[model samples]
Target: MLASWQMREGFLRSGRMATRRGVWVVALALGLAAGASAGEEFEGKLTFEVVSKQAGAQPVAMDYTVKKGLVRMDTKVAGMSNYTIIDPAHKKMSMVMPAQKMVMEMAIGSVEPPAPATAPEIVKTDKTERVTFNVVDATTLTLVKEGEAAGAGAKTYEGQQYAVKVGDRNSEQWIAKDLTLLAGFVETFKAMAQGPNAAWMKRVEWPGFPYRMVTKDAEGNVLSEMTLVAIDTKSPDDTLFTVPDDYKKMTMPQAPPAMPKE
Candidate 1:
């Protein structure tokens, strides 16, 4: 079986954002807000053709299927590998890594909010990074931030910035100036901080990674971009979020020594 690091590395190397969950939320919210004539629940399939390329490697094509609250990812890597099942409501995820011939399960839980800090303390932290939220009229919000990082400390403010705490990660978010959150930094950061299978928090702050995303269309026109995707809703269904009863389950032991990073 592939080591944890190996799996993570493979994901990173794929050149696709790992925050599929966040993207799903933002996409759904936006798609619904735009597509829906009135406030209503939406249920449909979203298909995206993922094209990836790495130095000295041939381009790779993959198909992604996302329903209301479920996702099934299929990739044509080494062997017909498939990644199925992500249920945030139940805090469970399943994966089928064909290259490693393994089926794995992971347990997850929702994040709780942090206690409020006093003004003096907030002012001190404001010198570095700070988050705030504000209401723009009645149907919109604004989140803003200004400063640098100071270790892993977190704070929340009310203005153009919003800071939400998710799990052990605190994400500082800045909402879009005009388009609410459908197309802005808040959606982008949310996607990066949380993976596709996790729940979304009102606000959060997390250590940023040293990577960026660039999106383009067939005509090479620069378009929307983000680091990962996040899905912040209940699980889709029992069958979609679990391993098939008929499939054989396998577990592999960890290697004695870790492989050196490439």
Candidate 2:
């Protein structure tokens, strides 16, 4: 039989062990909370400037604004404006034409994209690098510019450079892992990259938000380049996602009657 003192000491030691275990549990909980917050979807407006290599082609400004589960895309060039609104949950898309004062509505199918039979190989560089902007000057690839001169007044982030190849097309992306796109938006975007027309996109995937993405052809010639020039975290007005009341609804034009066979 053990003495009272021995029993008391045993209970005290057990109490100490339980206290230490409690501390570990609390610490782990806190760490998990922090990780969840870091991975939360980014809600804001993103502006990407698209540069074309064709002669006499003007640079187009593409703006995407997300708020409260709604997405809006606006493109305006040479006094012509076009807007596309998408509601993923409801599976609806609306094309708002300001010039025509019309809204063309269509139902987007909720098709789940099939997983790629094989994941594309991604190579990451050892060091982080700043994104470079390709300046096109009058039908010529003038210079590969970097720093503020290339993207003035734009937010810059140093990210890991990844080389991604999808079939014949090749692309390089500067991805900032700290920033994540809205989960719903990513799903909807992937869902839309379906069907026979978008087979190439089905093979493309992003690990995180890309600050810059440049796609090149088989010959290494630049095809399309887009850079993120601005980002705003403030929630935009809900009205931006809604069609204007004054706009008239329009149906898709029907195909012309078939010619009679001889």
Per-candidate Cα lDDT values, in order, are 0.34, 0.52
Model 2 agreement with the true structure over 1-262: per-residue lDDT tens digits: 5765665455345334323222222222222233334554435666667787767777888677766556677776676677777665575556677765667665544232344443555678676865443333322111134533553333334578887665555767677655443332332332222222233343356665566677677788886677776556667888898988998664432211111111
Model 2, backbone clash pairs (residues 3+ apart or across chains), number:
0
* TM-score for candidate 1, residues paired by index: 0.34
Candidate 2 has an lDDT of 0.52
Q: lDDT winner among the candidates?
A: 2
Off by over 4 Å in 2: 1-41, 111-119, 131-156, 180-207, 253-262
Model 1 poorest 10 in a row by lDDT: 253-262
RMSD of each: 15.1, 24.5
Error of 1 at 121 (Å): 27
Could you tell me which 10 consecutive residues in candidate 2 have the lowest summed lDDT?
A: 253-262
